[model samples]
Target: MDLRRLAVAAKPMHRTLHALPRPNCQDHAFLQMRRLATTDFSFLLPRRHAGLRSFSSTQSVPLSEVMPRDGSRADLKILPTDPDYLRLSVESMANMSRSEVSQFVFMMNSYGAVILSSSNRKEDRLAPYTMLDRLFGTPVPHDSMNEYGIVEINPANPTSINTANPIKEHLPHTDDAYTENPSMFCTLQCIQNAPSGGGETVLISGAELVAALSNKELKSLMTPGMVSLGRRPASDGSWLKVSSIPMFWVDKDSGWLQVRWRCNDGCVQSIDSAARPAYEQMDAVARHAIHQLVIPLVSGEVLIIDNRAIAHGRRSYEKGEPRIMWRKNYVGDGEIASELRNGLCPSYSSMFEGMWSMFEPKLVAV
Candidate 1:
């Protein structure tokens, strides 16, 4: 967590928390997939709410017909030549007075992740912060406990939110699972590499994960309500119980899916007894999907992934070996460029309790 690196201002930010009403045709994937495959529709039927129907499968807009997923897609293996790779290299960022805001947005929208090249000769890990600030105006503080916007990803000093052991495999999860808005994008700037080369970065696309699951499983996972991810005990002798969150949701405006699943957080905690099986099954499937794309990061590379669309983790390394990386989380600037990010459509909200209120029928029924 490179929490100390960001520049904070005295003036208060002008941001609003209210989100747009949930659209009728938000998630088209499950609907379309259901149409293609004759699975049980009994669980997914629309429920009458105050004499008004909530959702109907026949009304859902086809995602493929509306917006094809043919945009420039690249995973963690993105190289320099890949169009998804941001050209904000150490040299380019150093040479130019301002970061290429357009390029950053393009790469972010095209691919859920981008590999930023750092200077081999010098430690230019700090350069990405300048570029990030330009792209996303404000850096959201990691948590109330640690107010720093950036944090050094040292396994030795794991935070309370992350209690996993340093040498153990860090499971795939999005940063700040305890909040309504986790960072829209996260940067992992490599500072030091382990001598034995055991630690590797792992990334999993949420879209791909849903694609792998059956329609029934997808519908079950999207059920709205609190997921009971546990609590956050602070130093003030007070503890906050964090519960009732969703794992996967979609943008009402774009129909683009957004996922927020952390093994340590809401992924394992099922508040609803009936949904426990679905939640557990989702975790197992997510673990399977993440193993498909593992990336090795050396000392001079920074990886920026869409926090909402992709899940990331680290491989366990030897005890004596050294591994160091700086991490920073950035929320959408509400500016055009930052809003264009893959999972950050304007009406974005924590779909768990907000836009997905309509799922109460199936979610509770299960």
Candidate 2:
């Protein structure tokens, strides 16, 4: 860890706790000989929910179809990139004065995420991913839109819910595992035209998901948790410290949110033991509470959901043709999050305290 960084982070952010919070409207891939071969239907899907229903589950709606997935055909089905979407471009936002920009960010921050669309491809500066990255640090690396695997919609693959491995889709989730200091926030720049299928990304408000759950369910989810990430075996025959983080942790002073969960390769095999219980809990409670997701999506439309307070996923693809999007994930900047943004990042000290605590038990006890 950056020691100079740690020195600055050790100080306590004592007075920053009272900052008012606000609300806002919100809101991967790879291939190497194909990570997923089309073999078993349950390849990495959940056994229970992975069982997609009929055409609704197996088939996806393609962009070419003027008919809705539900069988409603029309002369012109609305695409996510329709003229209405481009109207929300960042240039439109730029025309807003400084105060307006500040207010826009303030409103969006309070609400957790925002969306922007444009007719321009990735080059558009005001496009979804670029704007958010400029606002927040680059959160996480993911497959470029050019790399997103495209597929046709069929009933076999219903909603893009993860049953077995989450390492597949970068759902409308947070940037990292549970902690108060999340990365600067995640942004996805839509890149492909689905001609069909992949019409919308879906999300459930994390707060709403929690609110809708039963006490028994919530209790299990709130406990100190960890995640068991997987990786290659080491010389010692042990896998890498894939990662062990809680699903949720509010900062001691400031109430910023933090989270950690799996998407794609991170979700499968060789998970750390510490994270198992929490992962299981999340899966269970999240199962029933997930009905909160009914949001639709489209090309050029960007979806930014709070990883802390929301769970996100995608709609089924349009059969024979699929939509693709370029994704760049992010974590909120926690260390600089104090009301006094200029002060040292608290997480630095938090880091040393973490280091000292480990050895202090044995060193001091002596």
Q: lDDT winner among the candidates?
A: 1
Q: Which stretches of candidate 1 lie over 4 Å from their true place?
A: 1-90, 94-103, 143-148, 160-164, 212-220, 230-241, 252-255, 264-267, 289-291, 334-339, 344-366
> How does each model score on lDDT?
0.51, 0.35
- Candidate 1 lDDT: 0.51
The candidate that wins on TM-score is 1
lDDT of 2 by residue, 1-366 (tens): 554443344222211221212111211011101112111112122222212231322233221221121111111111121222212344442233344345334323333444665444444434343345444444553221223221212223322223112223434344434233444445554555445444455544344333333322322333433344443321233443344444434344432233444433333443346444534544544444233344344555665544544455554443545454555555544322331111111111221121211111111111
Model 2 residue 158 lDDT score: 24
What tens-digit string does per-residue lDDT give for candidate 1 at 250-298? 5543444567766643234445766665556556755773233677777
